[model samples]
Target: MDAHRKQRQAQHPSLTITDMYNVLEKLRSGEALSAKEQKTHEQGLVSILLQLHTELDAAVAAAYGWPANLPEEEILERLVALNKERAAEEARGLVRWLRPEYQNPQGTQQTEIGLSTKTKVAKATAKETLAWPKTLSEQAQAVQRALQLHERPATAEDLLYQFKPVAKPQQGQRLQQIDSLLQTLHGLGLLRKTELEQYVK
Candidate 1:
């Protein structure tokens, strides 16, 4: 792991992984880092990591047959569309099992599960509502889309309502997830926070 980190660091000579970790440790422990430490953190690993992540995202988008430079709203929209398409395929008995050996077993035909009228209605409703994305990157993009649609600064609660109905039991967890994503988006400069603790793109 250290060697891999060093190789990545070598790709961006200005970034110092050690200094970044030191600064992060200080901040996480509620200790203030000096001006120099702060500067190192800003100019070091964080910037390099962001650049690397951008490249990775572009590559993944290309692999998905999507435009690499798509905006956050478009990315989330495309993802949602793809998800619905997959669900529709599954409804028609086309199950694309990732681990066929474990999921389908040998020589066993996959059975088509018939959907009831009520279940189909529920699914149609779900298709109209955006679900929380499973991956952190996509979740961040969803937050960005929410902010764009809001057209004004929005509190986390305001953004949460844009997604699919969260169960009462999961509301707290979902709120925390939104808060973390908000902080991450703010740190990446994809979002800005108002004095009132609202987020805007």
Candidate 2:
């Protein structure tokens, strides 16, 4: 039983409310999650469901003053309702964080960076053939650093800056190299440039 518990723990580490919210947010926005990220997200969802199931089961048992066992359908129905309530609560919280003050489209409002500009950049960046110059390990390191910053649609400079010794100087001759990398990412549709240069998710 201890071994079983350990195995379960390894497979299903507990997730916090924020972890579930992040997973849901990524899914809602149609963001692509790598296999590892997807696995973590699924584990988090399962953990939330299991917790809800236990709570509902206890509540029903207490209410009826009955045994631990309940009909599967009844349990499921209650769980569904609980999930809906949780979702609503989460949405309200998200709205508070996503209020208009923080809500800005990628450079769309600027006359200089209007639809045409976006389209041009997006088209250039949306090429499926373009690949990152970094190795898998290096790319993962860059992505990890980018995740630490509050910025969304992190600029090419921002990503390269995170690389430090691995990346060239920020200005002069290195500017063209940085631009080339960003353009490559944009062509590959990996990064979306938004208004105010914010990159989310």
Candidate 3:
């Protein structure tokens, strides 16, 4: 039993928060790990896995009104499975960041393409100006279509660009109308101002 304990201790090295942070920093910076760094990362990974397994066992035991008696090998196996799942979830979040519809921040009211960074004024305001619709049905349908086409927070300019074949109001009137719609949607929390002034869903 003493020999078995020693073997297990040798396999699972202790890790500190500093070690974990170092591994994360290296990963974020896209740096190639040295042999020592690689070993540290492996140790840190194993440490987290073991800690999670122990926590889970304790939680499960408490929930069932029993004391935990989880074995080390079982904890190690569960940790491996959980780590894979965590990696997959992170990859999915990265994919979302790359998608055009979600790539931009949702709350920006306008794009500040050439604005000086020193300017204190916001690129756009969230002020509401949309005129109430004469008929709820028409308004609802328009909103639904806009959402389907990924035109959420769609500016009048964007609408005009998208549906060029459709006749539209004069530029002044069109701008006013879009502002009104944007106000209504913003109030409903369907759209928000993204970075600078760009609006998105």
Best by TM-score: 1
The best candidate by lDDT is 1
Clashing pairs in 1: none
Per-residue error for 147 in candidate 1, Å, reads: 1.2
lDDT tens digits, residue span 84-103, model 1: 87799879978755434457
Report the lDDT tens digits of candidate 2 across residue range 108-134.
231111112222222222222233334
Regions of candidate 3 where Cα sits further than 4 Å from its true position: 1-137, 150-154, 164-169
Which is the winner by TM-score between candidate 2 and candidate 3? 3
lDDT of 2 at 149: 43
Q: What lDDT does the true structure give each of the candidates?
A: 0.62, 0.44, 0.45
Q: How do the predictions measure up, each by TM-score?
A: 0.39, 0.24, 0.27
lDDT of 1 at 124: 23
